[model samples]
Target chain A: MKTVDARGFSCPEPVLRTRNALKTLPAGEELEVLVETVTSRENVRRFALTQKCEVSFDETEDGFRLIIRKP
Target chain B: MSDRFTRFFASRWGIVLTGAVIGLLASLLQKAGNPPNMGICVACFERDIAGALGLHRAAVVQYIRPEIIAFVLGSTLAALFFREFKPRAGSAPIVRFILGVFAMIGALAFLGCPWRALLRLAGGDLNAIVGLAGLVIGITIGVWFLKQGYTLGRSYPVPASVGWIMPVLMVGLLLLLLFQPQFSEGGAIFFSESGPGSLHAAVWISLGAGLIIGFLAQRTRFCTMGSIRDVILMGDTHLISGVGALVVIAFIVNLIFGQVHFGFAAQPVAHSNHLWNFLGMVLAGLAFALAGGCPGRQLFLSGEGDGDSAVFVLGMITGAAFSHNFSLAGSPDKLVDGALVVGGISTYGQAAVILGILVCLVLGFTLRERFE
Candidate 1:
């Protein structure tokens, strides 16, 4: 598993970074995305799903940690 | 560590507090000297700055607003402090610039932006209802475009200097403001002797307000367009709660200051022409949606090194100049026989607005990836 720390970037940036990270993520691998706001968390999940990646997220005390599995 | 403080500001309550503070500060700014119900309008302030720089010849509205300058500088400070200042660009800059141009045209047509719309409604201006309805309609349409997988493409990391452009430009503006220089007598840098341009809070107070707002808005990622977009797209009310708090707190403060005037007619710096008011905001809302943030948000993003957003801000300044030069901006209605008539945009403005809508729809349709 690899992690992308997008905790402070605003909306769409985090999503874009997630997509960039998943580009070379190889099949059947998981990527963890840390985000600081609820909006970023949801936006990243939505964007990841559009890329055909399975996505789930857990609420952290500060924000959220999204687990994306590439298909 | 400052993480605990960061967590609180990022929380639901924290956002609400941020909105509340903005509401209170805006009201006080108005009391101090800003235009009525326009203590913090991004579009109007930017237009004034354009006039001040001789971008347009609108004499009654020429002044380099410190609040505008401080917004970028303040956001730069916050981004640096939080280690969030990542310089990046290359996300369809031309398209974002066009969106910014159209957004300004629409906003000037209505004489307000989304923030001003909310503040107007809070101040008991009934015309805002029509404008806000237009905003919702535009946002809903943009939501549809998003549902269809519209994106402006990806932005990549660039050199740190790229992000410093906006802040440096802001510093230059501040110096020009302080020095009040003239290349020749009555040439270049201009200032309004009367009208809304001359009316403003003390420079220090305005700077303080902009700094506080810039800092909090950066930390919380506060955006008026995003608030409406989130609700329509995902049933998320996280951002709207802050927006709600803004209206509520501002309304209370306005009432305390005796600034609440409820009417469709006779509003300051606004028009009563319902149709243009509605249509103008429709264009602005759509532009905000398609471009990914409102005018103020764009300024904040530029401060943090988003070059795409910086292009959008430049587009807006250019649009303001175009609007006044072409008589496309709306004027307030004349009060006749104790009755206020409707002030509407010029025919050219109407045409520009219609054309802008077409452009936005075209952009929305063309800028999406095929998900197969």
Candidate 2:
């Protein structure tokens, strides 16, 4: 699993970073995106789903950990 | 995010800070000769630009605003820098143009765009509350259409040359400004001697500010309509925060500069009719949402070579003309009481807004894709 820390960043930027990271992501591997804002968390989750990745999330004290498994 | 400055600039707080800086600078511009509480209104500026072009004879709002020209040119530069300039067109051009018209009508009725509304509120104009509410309500209505899968249809690629047309026009407008000929009855341009048309920052300052805003907005995709739409459609608050900061900071700045005199009546470039302010923005907001962007967004899109958005921009210019010519525009310090402003749309504006909204609703229902 590769971790992408998008915490503290505003949206679209985080979403953009996630897309860039996913392009080089290996198939059948897992990725984690950490986001503080619920908006970013939801956006990253939605974006991962759009890319055919299986998505789950863990809400932590700081923010959210979005677990994405590449298809 | 690796670079320290990039990380800082792209951070959430950084966006908020940037928005604050813009608010502060906007206030300074107003103090430095821009219209009160109107440092950078895309609709109003475009309308002024239209007047400068002799598209309309509205003397009060006629000026060749260099900022308007800078916005498109700056965005073009950024687009080329990022290799994101793709020229395309043919997404219901007529509908977009009509929407742009209504958007201007609605804005003129209120005498402000979304950005101006926020600035007005921040400057202690209570009437803006109604306008802001109308905006949210209008956007909420637009979200309903989105839920129904409404779309403006897809755009197709065109020759790259087509993308240069809008920018070329902008350059032409600039050249006309550089060589200001005496104003004749039907000259190439019209320059306002006084009134809101005449109030402006130094040409270089205005252009520089416009250029910076254009480039930053392009890179960040900063849009007032999109911010509200995203909140409704995706529960995203990212852009909204930036907007909130703009309002808050502007309010504080206004206070510091003694521009904060709180009252509903006698606001700069704004009227006292609460109902029209609400309905006018309702019309403008719905039009913006239906058109898929705000006036500023349309300009930015035009900069990036979107022919559809360029058409919309032209439509707005035409609409601004109709607004003044047809008495659809509302005015400050001119209190015409007792239905003087029809249905809160200032006489003819109400009719146009109603018709525009009805068209948008109809288009919303008709443009949806079939699920079967």
Candidate 3:
């Protein structure tokens, strides 16, 4: 799994980061996004899901870990 | 790696504190004669700026607001210091401009922006509830559009000189203010002798306040619309917390200062119609979300050389002109203070906001985005 840490970034910035990283995902590969705010986490997940990727997440101690898979 | 206050001010706590300070300052500005609860309304100030420039002939709302001029100049200085000034534009300029126009129309109908709405509520006005609800719904609709793959395209970098235009114009406007060509002797500028337009903080004080606020807000990336958008779109409360502090602190300060006179009846510069206030902000909120920032944020962006934002700012001023010219703005009852008008929504104002919302939605849904 490839990881992209966006914990300190704000909205739209984090979403933009996840968007850029999503471009590199090959079919069947997974990307995990780390974000501190619920808004960022959900936005990243939304972006991934909208891209036809499968998405899930875990609310961790620090924040959230969103796992996305390109279909 | 810094002083205690510096460290705190730069952190999340700093942003909240900044908002609280802003809230208190707004109340104080009001007490010092800034037209009731309108100490810092970007939309209203811009409108007044427009009237001052003779962009419109509205007798009551004409004055070159030093605060707005200072907002741009101060932001420019801050951007220069931080080396964040890079001029950019061409992100659907025409569309952004149109969005700006409708945003003003909606705000005029509601008689306040998000900031004023919050202040009105703090002063014990119940009417802001509908407007607040309208803002949330509007942003929520924008979120729906976002979910459907809506995009305004991306902004690309332009020559750095391009970004200098807005700041330079701001300087010119400031010089114009100091020299204040006389409208009395048929001087080229318009000056309101009375009404909200006549009411203002001393020029230097307002200018200083504007500069401070512009610098701080630019540094903090503070925005009310962004706060609500973040919440509705992503459940983000980071920005919302700052606004929460603003309201709370303002409420407290208003109480201490004896500015808190709550109720649905005759709140400062506010009308009683709940429905129009709600629908009006819905239009404004949708327009703000679609344009990617609020009026103040747009000014900050313009200060940093974003031509797109500058164009939007111009659009808002033009829209303000049209609103007053066409009687599409709110006014108080016939026997009210100035009696010239304010606070109640006009029929045309209602029509304008509805049209604004419909047109913005069409623009939103029609712009197809590539999901693949």
Candidate 4:
């Protein structure tokens, strides 16, 4: 699993970071992203779906943790 | 409902007052140093910025405008202070982007946005009157769509950090301006060597004026499209009255400052293509209507942390690039392709307006609650 910390980033940053993380990860590996904003969670989820990845999300105190598995 | 109009203005006087102040300051900026008929144009300035960032190669209109930077920052401060700052998105982001693109294309075709269009008319550019008419017509069409169920969708809550994208970009640009980093020979910051882009007030003055205007506009909700929209839709003249006040005041100020020159032939940074001016503004007005606000209003909304508005703004910047790159934008020298592009775009806009109205009518009849 590759974790990308994007908790404080805004708008496109979280998505951009997630894309970068996915790039470095091998196929079928999990990429976990920590994002603070609800928008980012939704965006990441949407992006994961578009990229044909499976996503499991859990809410934390400050934000949310999103794990995406590349297919 | 009666009080809604009154309350809107009461709460929004800040927008009106700031809009007027911006107008006055823009005039002053022009008088002092900026280009003629372009004291502070949001679309034009953004186009310059896009060029500065190497988005397009429009040599004649490229310069980084500080007023734009100040607008976002000032609005950000105001929103933060008022606790109205909410960063949200996902209201059909792609659609908003497309609207922004069309909006820029229309504005450039008309040679101005609604604010500048009005100012252009006030300054005796008769072409602007045509543009204004087209704007009104376009808004009327948009209102029809509103009467329908044509919404961009809903915005859900986003992280506070999501709102900082444009602000951070602005800061980065300001840093570039301050540092003047070595990029290329001949000051390739994409500044216009000798055109409309070359004309500008000093950076500090422009930024200061923009900040003040942004602060005031955020408070007033002063929107050119909304002014007409309210008056036509509900017979509420509050916003329209403020708009009228702006025109009269601007004219008076122009006269006092010896800026009101009569005749249209040699007007600064404008052309005498009356038909195209009308058509161009028609496209702009329709795009603004579909997008739900004028360019200035979009900027203010973005400042208040509206992601949908921000999307529209980015769309416009991209549209500016497209227009220039595709030769769809006009210039004082002559119309691009000499009337063909104008006619084609005008037809497309009109068709879109007609289609939009038809859709609205259908939705209005079908989607009503029918609470008889």
The most accurate candidate by lDDT is 1
Candidate 4: residue A16 lDDT (0-100): 55
Query: On a 0 to 100 scale, what is the lDDT of residue B84 in model 1?
Result: 70
lDDT of 2 by residue, B58-133 (tens): 8888888888898899889877876658777877899889889989988888889998898888888888889989
Query: What tier of docking accuracy does candidate 3 attain?
Result: incorrect
> What does the TM-score come to for chain B in model 4?
0.86
The DockQ-based CAPRI class assigned to model 4 is incorrect
lDDT of model 3, residue B72 = 88
For all predicted structures, in order, the TM-scores are 0.89, 0.82, 0.84, 0.74
What residue pairs are clashing in model 2? B276-B344, B342-B347
Looking at candidate 3, what is the lDDT of residue B322? 89
Any residue pairs clashing in model 1, and if so which? none
User: For residues B1-372, what per-residue lDDT tens digits would candidate 1 score against the true structure?
Assistant: 677767777778978988898889888999999999898899999999999999999998899999888888888998899777878888899999999999999999988999999999989989889999999999889878876767886677789999899999999999998898997888978989999999999889999999999988877778888889878876667778988999999999999999899998879999989999999999999999988898888998898888998999999999999999999998887798987677999999999999999999999999986422
Candidate 4, superposed: residue stretches over 4 Å from native: A1-71, B1-16, B184-188, B333-372
B-chain TM-score for every candidate? 0.98, 0.92, 0.94, 0.86
Worst 10 residues of 1 chain B by lDDT: B363-372
Q: Arrange candidates by lDDT, highest first: which order? A: 1, 3, 2, 4
What digit string (tens of lDDT, one per residue) describes model 3 on residues B81-123? 7656767777788988999999999998888888888888888
